[model samples]
Target: MVAIALCAIGCQNLSLPSASTATTPVVIKLSGWGSDPTEQKLLKQVLKDFETQHPGIRVKYEVISDQYMDVIKTRLIGEAAPDVFYLDALEAPFLMSQNVLEPLDAYINSEFDLPDFEETLINSFKYDNHIYGLPKDYSTLTLFYNKQAFATAGLTSPPTTWDELLTYSKQLTVDKNQDGRIDQYGYGVIPELARQAYKIKAFGGQLVDENGYAAFASEAGLQGLQLVVDQYQKDRTSAQKSDVGTNSGSEMFGQSKVAMVIEGNWAIPYLKETFPQLDFATAEVPTINDKKGTMVFTVAYVMNKQSQHKAEAWELISYLTGKEGMEKWTATGFALPTRQSVAQKLGYEQDPVRSAFLAGVEYAMPWQAGKHPAAIMNNFDNQFVSALLGQQPLKQAMQRAQAEANKLIRAME
Candidate 1:
């Protein structure tokens, strides 16, 4: 569920000391996707601050360029894994089951404000009630509407229901040049596993049973996802995930090519910088029927169970994810803080631009986790796309995916 995108890097360029003897740099290695220039700078500064605060330990950061999983898996299998690496909600289950992640429950205990983090996000890292990680940053989904497009369609506020979404989309969509084809799409959705999974829940479907087995062939699941495909294939109001090339949902909405998009807090800065001419506003994601829900994803700094210097690792984890560090990192509005205290202190709960995302937290479900999460996703996405293209009925496509996922999961069991 936590599909980290590449943006907001370079926090600060604080220098870290090499693995040493007196300071006895018990190097704690951290791994994750590449970040934006600014985030990277800020992170480096944070690490340097960690080093200065705990002169007894040293921290190292590593990022994979390509085939990221393969690289991490190779290192892990060879026992060359990072002491602290990033884990997404979608990928956590598999890694945690393999005993790759250290359970943070004992470490977290009463010292940290565990209850202050978003409940939806906190539970994502829990397997069998054993906590494995602490969320460093978190975000929730919201509706981003292009104000000009809304005014052009004679609409004031964005829709709050599925039916209204369809109606507004039809009104906002247009063929500007009018040669023959449509120049602007009314709405769009990224058909990735994470986004589609959000849709599945919104429509009262669960991807897997409570026992952690596949169950996406259910009526609610298929109907939920079919809504997305039908809008594009039949209603002609939404664009295919790939139709916009490399432009993100925010980019498309900002260009006025799409009237509405369900995006997160991270895109606000990009929109302000890349498309300053566009007028936009954020609203809570529309309800499906009468239910209101969204997907929540998070990441945390976790210590390695196998590390000889856990005390040192916890020192960094504690500082970086603590109130002070989280507050500084979220100061630029790059991401929404997971802590309720940080969120309140930053006034994100009151800002209109962030209100919807903040509100979504109360109902947003965590992205699925556990062993076979990636495989489950890979198989579902392929069959889901086939269903979207009409090559197979929604039921059959999902059944096929469900069957395959069950087979894979059973083998592991």
Candidate 2:
């Protein structure tokens, strides 16, 4: 029988004699994104709960905010990476290629509810027909609108089609404290490659070619992506990138500066906590050309291939993704449960905000995970931003993005 060592406060090995006196915990590092105070607090409770149940492990958690990929790559290459880290579905291809992430298929089969997970979530982590991780949380984009703003605009329901969205946005936009200036925006768009993925997919445009090369330069792709940009520059109903600092849309929505915005499920908790006074509700993100959809951003818990503590790590992974741990970890309303059984058990699939989140799961296009995504994203972001700023025709921008992405994609192959 494999022994489960019990320790507390930290993850340092208690087996060593003199090491026991060390102030630092037996450090098992965990890395992820998010420095939001509420998320951090929620994590603490989960960690504490883990320590309480399994006494021997001490976790040293770190949030990688800036140059995230570079830092993670450096640590992983140096073998100093965290024992448990967040693996995005988009970057799974790159990380899996590095041969660093351990396969957790056996663990899932042996210890957990193998059939209980949603097939869509399970398939995201599968590489070479092998499982690399267990998804801990997921977010799908939705249309968040300020209720009061809609009421003021004399609108009762949110827009459903592309034309209606444009008209509604223009109507809802106002110069509330008009000093010959427009203060409130009708809508907002995040002009980055990472966030705008759903635009292409919504209109049946593929981001990659049949051979898994960059393919977002198609006529359909340009049409889908341009619609959002046109709403800002041409239609004058969307917020410009510089209108709000940092996360323009999220911030604008929180302050009621934008009437409608496209953000993920995480934004719900954020708005609820940060701007409690704001009257906000969510709906499915409006479609392009009358087709409905959005994006998926998900993170999974992956095991370290070189872990000296594989047995222990597997135990943790199994338990963390198991019915009990998943229930506890997702209990705080921080994220949407990826497992169908868990969703059903928690009634998350039926809850208002959560149900809207759940509704979008089937339609959400996965965020890019192609190898050399950094280079591709760099090209895509620059070109896409050009379209957003009205500096380039949408066709030219996407063509440039697709060509650049293909070049980088070819080099990696």
Candidate 3:
């Protein structure tokens, strides 16, 4: 009887038992951070549709508006976490290694068409041959360039290489008045590790050693980072958010403070809505060291191992990440679908603004650095910014960051 029930709930071909037949609907909780209002509305609709399909199950969705990870962690320690929750790729490594997540391999079967998902994304949630979560969607970084700025600068197309990007920056930067205070910079830079990880990898630098120790202070790493420092400090072609009195790269580009910025898919809608008059387009991140690279941000739906309604939780996870659910979720272009079939069906590759982001999926680096990612990321960002600002030598800053991160990782162990 138990085997039959499990199959009826998990196997798509098997008809689910009607609500009338069940004594009570099994209520399962789902939790994730708050997003755009439209995104939230779409999710609620998806959940409603899920309930309709499986009348025997009810979903109680909760939004953790701020400090999502911290709240989730506290709940997990108390065994009060939701049955299903969102886990980002960066945080996936730590949680997957902790043995608190349900290994989803048993629930997944051939009918799920697991092959449809992007390999890189699916692999992020896998540990020791057991799949812990299914990536719901992902985004890749791409160059967002202002078309008017390009035209005024007499440039025909977006930069195809880092060298070209730097050259274009110098040409695009302009000052309308005779004042020394420049009105615009060529590029807007986000000096955080998440944004610069691919740059490090461009020159064959590893973020961490096999033992999970920070290893980004190598010569290869410095070689790539030097490009950023030089562009900011020496050439003065790029401006950070603080420099331009903006909160984000999108804002800087929207205000015409920078002609170009490397940003993720989320910037598309924002730019369109906030700055309706601005004309912009996107291209794949320019190649560095003759290698194509960008960073990918992905989040997955993971199940709590301690959930009472394990089967129902699996049902919700499978449906949300399944092809049908993914299609509806990604139709608005808020996020790029992780499933290849869905992407093809949506025709995102042909989308002028999103095509570049789609093109980058093949070479994009997942924003993860082993189990102790926070230590590595926080330390690197702090030191890398100092280097970018000329407060310290790039080599010295990275070395100090690497040592400090390793020390923290050691303490965690």
Candidate 4:
């Protein structure tokens, strides 16, 4: 009887598991474009803290140093993409329509405080009433002017309107040398679609038609863009990076090649690190057409539709874009937090350099259009440069570019 009782007890013990055993942790991969070392360090720290909090998951962070979107698209096509990745607002429309990104609406819960995000920034990533991505951070184009240059030019403050800017540019443009070539230009012009989209919208011009085709060749569109063309071709007060032999507009401004440059927040850290002695101040972008307008750029954290561990992926996205994580990431001021609460907590609105950007968020237009922006942007840049160089009229250049863009758009559809 004792042996039978002992055997029964052993059988019962075998049916139960030990408390020490735990399920294996899931590994989720994340990808983003490479940034400065400081930015990269902050991201790694955030990831580490997340790992500590959620022991059941490990994150694999990867940086695609160059051609990020092209590489990410290729990976997605091959079914070997990361679980989560950064999606720029400019590219968001195209990617969202691809049906490759996981819709995040169902995963977001009340605790996430979804309403805390700036509606303008949030809407940039929304499509068809679905939240495809959550903006991590955003920046608006602000007028960054060289203080010393301003003083030398006998100016007291930054230009307040487009007309004032043109007047200011003439005074700011200087040729120190006896040679015909200019030494310092009044402004550094990007002359790209990403930077010029707002100008198109300023004159009641739409970037696309109701059917999502390029329509910026309209009379209203050319009216706004003509301002840029006049500034470059007729005013001759602005110089592009190629003309200045610099890699970027910010660099030209930092090197004193231009008195002013319309740049985003990323230039702040770069200018501070590369040209600490440069005395510069930022102000809200000048008004155009008696209306406030500036281009707002943002990137969001999006999940892959093919991710095997959807729950784990959502957890990572939630944490990274959450209040605490966003605060930590934006602490260094490398990027502006998308969360209004976080921005207030950080006091970026009061910071002199960042204040200008914060102020423009209200009136800024998001830098995105319909699904065929890639085609639209490419054609516009190619033709707009010709117009800027005086090779073609603004209206004619836009007309030709729009026709080509619509042709490509039709092909894609």
Among all candidates shown, the one with the greatest TM-score: 3
TM-score of each model, in listed order? 0.90, 0.87, 0.94, 0.92
Give lDDT tens digits, candidate 1, residues 1-413. 21111011112222333334564557678787787888888888878877787777777888765776667666665556677777777777766655655677766866688898888887778877888887888878888998888998899999999889989999988999988877788997777777777678766778878778887778887777888888978998998646866467877777777889888788898899888988999998888858887888788666555555666666677777788888877877888888899999999989989988989999887777345676578778899888787899878988898899888888766
Q: List the residue pairs that clash in candidate 3.
A: none
- In each prediction, how many residue pairs overlap at the backbone (N, C-alpha, C within less than 3 A)? 23, 12, 0, 0
Q: How many pairs in model 2 have backbone atoms within 3 A of each other, for residues 3 or more apart or on separate chains, i.e. clashes? A: 12
Winner on lDDT between 2 and 4 is 4
Across residues 264-366, which tens digit of lDDT does each residue of candidate 3 receive?
Answer: 9999899999999999999999999999999999999999877777888889999999999999999999899999989989999899999998889887899
Q: Between 1 and 4, whose lDDT is larger? A: 4
True-structure Cα RMSD, model 4? 10.6
Please report how far candidate 4 places residue 311 from its true position, in Å. 1.5
The per-model lDDT (C-alpha) reads: 0.77, 0.75, 0.90, 0.89
* Tens-digit per-residue lDDT, 1-413, candidate 4: 22233223223321111122247888899999988788889899999999999888899999999999888887776678898999999888877766677788988999999999988999998888999999999999999999999999999999999899888999999988959889999999998988898888889998899899999998888888999999998899999999999999999999999999999999999999999999999999999999999989999999887777778888899998999999998988999999999999999988999999999998899988687788999999999999999998888899999999999988877
Worst 10 residues of 1 by lDDT: 1-10
* Model 4 residue 412 lDDT score: 70
TM-score-better candidate, 1 vs 3 = 3
Q: Please identify which of the two predictions, 1 or 2, would achieve the higher lDDT against the true structure.
A: 1
Model 2 residue 390 lDDT score: 82
